[model samples]
Target: MSDSLTLIEEMLGREARLFAASNVESDDRSHRTYIVADFEYQYHRSAHAGYQVAEGAAAEEKIRWPFHRIVAAAWTVLRFVPGQAVPEIEAPVVLTAETMDEKTMVTQFFDALAAMPQAIFATWGGEAKDLAALRRAAVEHDLCLPVQLLDLSPYSIRRLDLCNASSVMAASVHLPEYAAALAIPSKPSPRKEIGQLVENRQWDLVADQVAADVLTTCVIAIGHLKSMAVVTCDRPATIMALAEKAAETFPKSIFCSRSFRPWARDRLRAAGLRGTVFRAP
Candidate 1:
């Protein structure tokens, strides 16, 4: 196999192993749900532009700082799940309720997703409009979506967003800075605005993002099975908040790609682990 393929496989393998080993049981005796995930999308086009700042040194600093808090919220929720009756661990669900224009589709999609208790996830590209539509959809469908929503603006909150992880992973292989860090190839330069580059219309990029996000969610669930706490979110502020809280309670909270690393080294170490890693096999 080519070196490129080999390297990709290696990175994937390492990540899988790390996630597999993360399974540990919490002190509670309730049945562990492993993982529960939700997706966020912006309804106002202006809000979508904020994510564009995610390109340079600005992007790195932006992500490195406050985003921990956003991830922390997800952690906070997961930490308390034993006391609450979270929705069943159904098949994964995806929602795209970013604007009023998408009302018809969002309504239909919400109906379909609500029926799938095993899995449900969704995304939107605007802020107020998108969130409003989602609220309506939830109410109309007799579901509740009153949880905290992730807003990418204000630059104060940080979200450990995985929406761009596949691109980052793919680009790291070829870009000089990320390539060297990841020990991979540099990507060819692109000739489009950041907005244009991330247009969902580019089906290929969208698919990669969705796959990466879903995989991250699954890995997180596996960790939950081990009794380790799991947190998730789509906005930087929420992630930063979650991570910050986790850091206080756990010793080694780490934020990389879209998911997080265990903070406590001693809590329920390796409790529900089925294997040493996760893969399609």
Candidate 2:
């Protein structure tokens, strides 16, 4: 792997993903996948040049969704089985493609998700942004999309928007703020101008941003699971150890990758984790 790729892989996580930390009591609760995901897209600057968007109204209409091209996506999979302390967490696998070849990116993303048993797709505010972009991309590419991705109903069980779920659509709250409030470790002022980065084809930086965002959301999802009593831990150290145990099982290439030591040290921190190191048996 090139230096940039190595850096990204190290940041992304080991192998495919890690584990889900769920609270289902049903017989079918054997396995549930918490797929936290985020996508970055580039839009037609030629079409919207010099156009300022109105915040409250017409914002949706002003930013034409049809011109969107999904350039990159970060998929974080967390697989949790009842009675298991940690669900296999496939935190993030970054995918990148040219705007014209968006079909390939879209295809691989959903195809991989489809292959996962009992996947629940998630995003920050994907219902309005990511999902719509995907639907439009599918239309343009003539691809069959999963109904779960297309469904926007609040009653829909398969897709979840963490932003809406946690805040009830409070205008001031976003993923970063939510992470901060929860004491989730985040580098202050991470770059979020993903569209700009995507336009420049800076996929490495894009991956950096997207991957970290997915990680934050995954932790948040774990927080939700804890609140619902799906996952019971004596404290943050317990969660940390389980996550480390899961990471230790990953392939050697990723297992020995850089940044993992520090990455592991920081997680489930401030938000509820005490950073207790877990010793493997």
Candidate 3:
């Protein structure tokens, strides 16, 4: 194993020892783990594209993101002894407002989240509007919003911007610098002009671009951990296909593309995380 992997294993092993000591088990190790579910508003954009509801109505409605479902679903495939399961973690929720006035979308998310008794909602780029919306919605709705913040900025393995063309510009300028530091090739292309494309309202292209980001980001997020799940707002078909391919390539690694509802339950089962563990095996 690489030094990085070895160091990581040692850290996780230390934690596992503690975990096993606290539970009733022969070995102080568990297959269950936590992962950060990085939510992005994929369905929000889809609803706008399909005319299911006017953009105005969609903003007000508490619509679920499809990618959340995929994340939850993927959890069903993995199973292990449960004891405050340690293998799953999700990214902080990430949402982009289609319009400045649609801060209500953020509010709705937290309000719904607060309704859950025991919950962990992750976020990416959770500052500013995302955090603001969460606060406002949680307060106004009189809900208990339990959130553990996962900052994505510091640990960003790679970044893909789907909302606007600015991401292209940023990537073009930033990636080259990054590659040079790593002694890799630096290539620039006309597509680097993100501002212009966004101005043209190229929604499909935008989704495709962000989808690529979601895939890349999720892969990187899970790569470092011994066990993990990467929740995303990517379309189910796309996410599942990737996970399937990954499973084929890496038989030992478990990947799932499920929604939060079903997947969360699976997580509970696989991790044996229903309640607190008073003792370890």
How well does model 1 score by local distance difference test? 0.32
Best by lDDT: 2
Q: What would the per-residue lDDT of candidate 1 be over residues 1-281, giving only the tens digit for each residue?
A: 69899778756754553343233222333433222333322234343346545553444332221111110001112322343323223333333322222444444443443332222132211132334445544455544332122233412111222223324345322123432353221112231321243344443332223323333344333323333233332222322333334334433212222233232221123323455633231
Give the runs in model 3 whose Cα sits over 4 Å from its true position: 1-101, 107-146, 149-196, 227-281
Clashes of each: 66, 13, 48
Residue lDDT tens for model 2, 176-228: 77776765644222545666777778766665666666666776777776787
Whole-model lDDT values for every prediction:
0.32, 0.62, 0.33
lDDT of 3 by residue, 118-177 (tens): 232322333323434444444554443333222234222222221111233354334334
Give the C-alpha miss distance for residue 206 in model 3, angstroms: 2.1
Candidate 2 residue-wise lDDT at 208: 61
Off by over 4 Å in 1: 1-35, 38-43, 46-101, 112-133, 136-195, 229-281
Ranking by lDDT: 2, 3, 1
Provide TM-scores for the models: 0.29, 0.69, 0.31
lDDT of 1 at 12: 75
